[model samples]
Target chain A: MRKLIVVLTLCVISSLALVAQGTPLPDSTSDSTAQLLQQAHALYERLDLERAVPLLERVLSPGWSFGMTKAQRVDAYAYLGASLALVGSADSAARYFRAALERDPFTDLDPRRFTPGQVAVFRTARRQTFAVGARQVSALRFDPRTEQLSFTVVTTHGATLRVEVRSVDATPGQVLFQGESDGLREIAWNGLMADGRLAPPGRYEVRVDGRSRLLSRSDSTRVYFDVRHELPALEDTLHELLLSELRPERYPPSAATGDLVKGLGIAAGAFVISGALADGDLGSRSSALPATVAATAALSGVVAFVWRRHHAEAPENVLANARRRQERRLTNDAIQRRNNARIAQTILVIAPASGVGP
Target chain B: MRPAFAHASGPLVLLALAAGAPTAAGQWTVQGTGVLSVMRHRVDAGYGVEPSSGVLAGPEVAASLRDRLTVRLWTRSGSFHADGPGAIDRDVAEAGLQVDVAALRWLTVQAGTTRRTYLTVLARQPWTTVALGAEAHLPFTETGVTGIVRGAILPGVSVNGLGHPDLAIAVASGMEYRRGRASAAVLYSLERYRFAPSATATVERREQLAGLVVSVGWSLKR
Candidate 1:
């Protein structure tokens, strides 16, 4: 009887102790709130917001330590708040907004989206939020005479800035510059791809992404592109000019040749007329002079015909067609360059809701 | 019966006037010709007859109607020293009309009427002649050297309104040197005449008239 009572008491205490373990476990082996938050995000992306809300709530539940970085925590609460709001529980969403700002005082939402009025309840919570803004990389210009191209980026206070210069076409070129810098960052590019060859004339994009560590929830990024056209060398230009002159168009047979044909015809006709007038009486004299003049005319006519045949206009047409093909190729390249120059980007600002005002 | 000279001369004048018009093909052409000929008459032509050897100067006008046909008008006048029995000073006028039809590129058929009238002694006795002929041209590729042949049959001869079966013929062969619109040719032609017995002349008279005609011609077009 005594042994039985002791065993039963031991079992009861063990049951009570296990019940006293305050935090909830996701499952038997883990209480990782980050994994739970990731699962909830997947559910939210899948449009199962109702299911995602419960998972997000579990991450914020009492006695559960969601060991996430400052950025990660802001992201989690923002995801939960957004999911709760999507599920039509604005009141429940407001609590997560307040809790996010308690972690990072300058917390804000993506300004372009989720306007402050959308979460008016969080607007009162964000009294001490930090400002977030970005500057165009083109503010830092390179010297015109130098081969190197330099640029700079400016971010908000205590911000982490990353700048990159990449080809606008995005596929054929290598990263010309990529690095992290302080709130005020400066970079130089040698105008060459990773292959060490001088970059061809083309469009290139400069991108800057920034986040202030002092205020994890406020972040901004800017992207824009520029076009460069490299002029040809003098030797190349001269060579092309000479090459164009090499195959001269001789057809449409020049005006001088046409005049030659007309003049020859006239001379032949004059010989024929002269022969006619020089004809004499047939008594004792033979008519040899007229025959000689006729012979001169016949020979002249033959020469004129030969000249007309050799100077025909077909070769000029062939050269013209070749020139047209070259023009089309140049026009197509210009259009491609114009299209690249039209590259567009929208500035992105990333933030989340903040805490309620004290 | 009308005089044969009047019959032949009327057609000649008509041809001469018709050639004065032009055509639309731009191919209408007129040709002026000068011919100097030497002639020999076969028999003595009685009173005031021409000499055995005589010179005939003829001037002609010819027009080709497009490329297919040609019409020519000619007049010849001659003066001869009388040399036969009871001869006297004499003159003769000959007028003629000739038409040529191009039967082929190489061949042409011709017909003409000619009348010869004595101006002095035998003025009342005018002789008329009718001719049918064909000409062939053999052209060389050189466009200058050409061989020509002509033959004619004279079916009848008329004098003072009377017709005679004279069995007369004419033939010629020549070489020509030609250029576009211009040519020169020299040919020898033989014309034969035969007359039946008459009240005043008992035996038949056969006369062979032979001549070398030198001709130069030019084409004018509108």
Candidate 2:
């Protein structure tokens, strides 16, 4: 009796599922809700808001039949608003975002996405209080490439600052100081030696000093001097920056790729050994299989040769051209650097000594 | 239909394992909540609430290592409770890292590895909530080196790859006229992902998924 009941229950459940599947989807006329969402997504992906706004407005219309929860409605509003702002519709986007926030207060909506202009004002104000103490110094490293010398300074306050090309080793020496109000700075070198002539590509020492009156900081300074070489392109410089910023916990695979490769090799070896063991009759079959094996090998060789011939062709000719362009860009950048260094040297020589700041 | 439930059960067990684990501070955070689509379609009946779609919810945890370095781990599990054909659901997790090297006052360098569960683009998107399993970003990486420069021309670029059936490459570049609480950045991203042959029968029919996303954001804190 119990078995029969269980069987009946199963049958009923299966029948219900089948019925549900057979039932037609909600009517197309009632699909304005989904249509609105599709339109919004399409517009957002295309980076076009001009066409998406009116469609979204119609979908949000009160009479429109969309079976959406209050929360989902709020999300739609937020996304629509954000999309509008991205395409230069700030006022309208702000209104939508604010409306969404009112509907759903829990949303961690990023205000920054809505207001690009306001961010500049905020940063300027914070720059006024920018001051660093000696205790804030954590670590510092220097890198010199074919184009510029960069200094990476890590601070205890979770800030990483950089200084670029403070002085060139060549003639008519010029120094460039580049610093940010947010504890970041750089200095450039203009191909001039200390004696005011073109300097050789070699090592040089750089120094930085800072004092703030509001913080009552005097003589609280940190200094680092390191050897750096110039890089060929901005790409190379950027690559160096990425390598320096890799954190172990955040990017463990980057640090462990070597180990992973070794492990894969070991696993492959084990698979081969197991396959050999499984073919225990290999000794008996060797003589009989020699011809077959050779034929198979020959066939595989032919196939591989054909594949190689076809695969050897470049898949991306455009990419090859792009690479050539990149090389040219690098060359141009080097030339620019050299010319800038010469110009700086001329300025240094011609400028009045009294114009120098302390 | 029964098999789908069994397939869905596996992720549920994993979720139970994660939830049962002891909570740790700085190890977890309420990242955010949103809805994700199971598949892309032209027309449907409802709007906001997707009874047949998956409900996306999860936590994100970011921790610092040795002051200058930080690591972040996040997971999102979405499930749909519906009866009938085409009921869809999935769960995903990701981990990534960020490092800051201050060599100058104006530029800082950053680099790191990321697993499938931690792609930022998928996390930031409103629809398609499945955390891009194989997507990782080296946001400030140029060549193999990562660094930043301050003053005059503040330039940066990054290379990213998506894991899984679609091994895609994305290159991004950004410029910031940064000040204090108010800094504006214009970021441009281009991505290309190719689908596998085996994916023909599934919803992943497109041989390439290419798009561009440009975003500008600002923040204010008390």
Candidate 3:
């Protein structure tokens, strides 16, 4: 009876072990968190901040760590806070931003990174100041997109104001508004040409009617108005507006590894099949299989070799030769000395203009 | 004049202009660089300079919309020669799209399509390739609907289908020991295609090409 009991106990233990082995392991929260993070990043890159914010919040709530060091974590927090601010939730954004600052008190953080949208808000909120004076009717230009213009007027006031927007290219000779206030009356010109169309792209001028009242004398106020086109480069523009926002550090290298492994497995299988035919089989079947394998392997090898050679050699040779030629023309020491001299010359030239009173 | 007010207001005005003007979103920049290429074909007999040898010029343009999505367009024009005739000039254009999902920290799914004209000895041929792909630093290539798992024993991979009834699958894995400027990679790719018999050909052929590729790329952009 005792022997029977011992056997039963052993059987029970074995069954428990089998059951434990058969049951799959629990899913990892880290992986789910990472996936969520990736989705959020994609949404953010697509400019769907409305979608990204919620996804990021979800991932963050899971108490996830992207295998980052403490310093990196601090940086991540700051970026997260800034990103939130960009999507229009200023309060939450500010909270995250503060948290990031708290984590790294010594770092000189640029608040502008979090306030792209805020700049517009602030500008609109600021009090609108329109200049007052009897300005001359010399030239006028206006840009409706920027809601600004340039004008010239003959006024006695040394108080004549010139507003120049460097980022906009306004249409030339356009009139916008005409109005009055106090002893200081104003004429607002909605910059439009006589043809009822926006003026040609150039500098514009507006003449205020009451310039003489402020100046207390009639002096020609020469307002040189220049307009510049403020357009972002294609690459930068695309990156800002459409490219996915991915923090390269948060990505795992495992995906790349897994792909390599899968390919290796396929290659190994082929190699094994070819080896089996060569070693065990005989007659036409064996010979044909081996031959087929050898031919496929050789063709693949050639194609791969050609592709790599083309990709590497062509680009490298061109770049290397050019670099060598450039190097031959100027040694490192000589280049450094030349740069230093140029720097000195610039400093000397700018010093007088800076009113240092040499 | 107060220096503080002058300096403070200058940047403030600039910032206002940058923020308020929609025109600030579009601009053109010129990037000039020289590229010299040398290529040797394994199937072809001899090599001196590669078939395509010369300076390459291209216009690269990118645009951003709504602050999250970006589109990039690039056009390259150059000349290459076949063994028979005078050098033939060719033009190639490519466009790419990147979608950033905020949930994934390091992975941005990328899709690109490209068109090229092959000017050869016999005739000029046009080929268009479409690629719907995603790249992650992981090892497995996900396809169809199985791309959701973060650690499903499969790494992320890209699959591209060519216009010539050929399907290409490639998987790559590597480690960058010294901050990615220098690294080694092992890449494996499989291409399967059915080659139809041409007018001069005697047989129809179905072919599969599979191989391992080892590569190293240095970062020269910086």
| i-RMSD values for every candidate model | 14.5, 21.3, 13.7
lDDT of 3 by residue, A1-358 (tens): 9999999998677556535655222235545544555555555554657656655565455465545444554544544555665767666655655454344432223445435554332222111112233333333323444443333332222343332211123323333333222322334433335565434334443333332233243222223343333222221111121123322222234444443444444344344433431212111112232233334333334443444334333343445555654564456556556655443322100000111111
- Across A1-358, the per-residue lDDT of candidate 2 in tens digits comes to 9999999998677556535655223244656566556656555554556556665676667876668777667767766776666665666666666565445433334455535543332222222233332211222322322233333332212222333222323333333443332333333454444565544433333333434333433222333232223333322222222333332223222323332332233223223322332222211212211232223323333433444344443324335455655776787788677766544333211111111121
Which DockQ values do the candidates obtain, in the order shown?
0.03, 0.00, 0.03
lDDT of 1 by residue, B1-222 (tens): 223343444454444344445545577687666666665443433322233546776667787877579987887767555545554555666888889999999899999998877555555557688899998875532335454567788875776633374557776544456676676765555566656667656655554555555677656666
Q: Write the per-residue lDDT of candidate 2 for residues B1-222, one digit (tens) a residue.
A: 121222343443343334334435443321111112121111111121111322333333333333333343333344334323432232323223333443333333444443322112223211111212121222221111111111111122121221243433333222232233233322222223333334223333221111111122222221
Indicate the TM-score of model 1: 0.36
Cα misplacement distance, residue B15 of candidate 1 (Å): 13
TM-score of each: 0.36, 0.17, 0.22
Q: Which number leads on TM-score? A: 1
A216: Cα error in model 1, Å: 28
Stretches of model 2 off by over 4 angstroms after superposition: A1-358, B1-95, B98-167, B174-191, B195-222
Chain A: TM-score in each model: 0.30, 0.24, 0.22
Fnat values, one per model, are 0.00, 0.00, 0.07
Q: Which run of 10 residues does model 1 chain A get worst, by summed lDDT?
A: A344-353
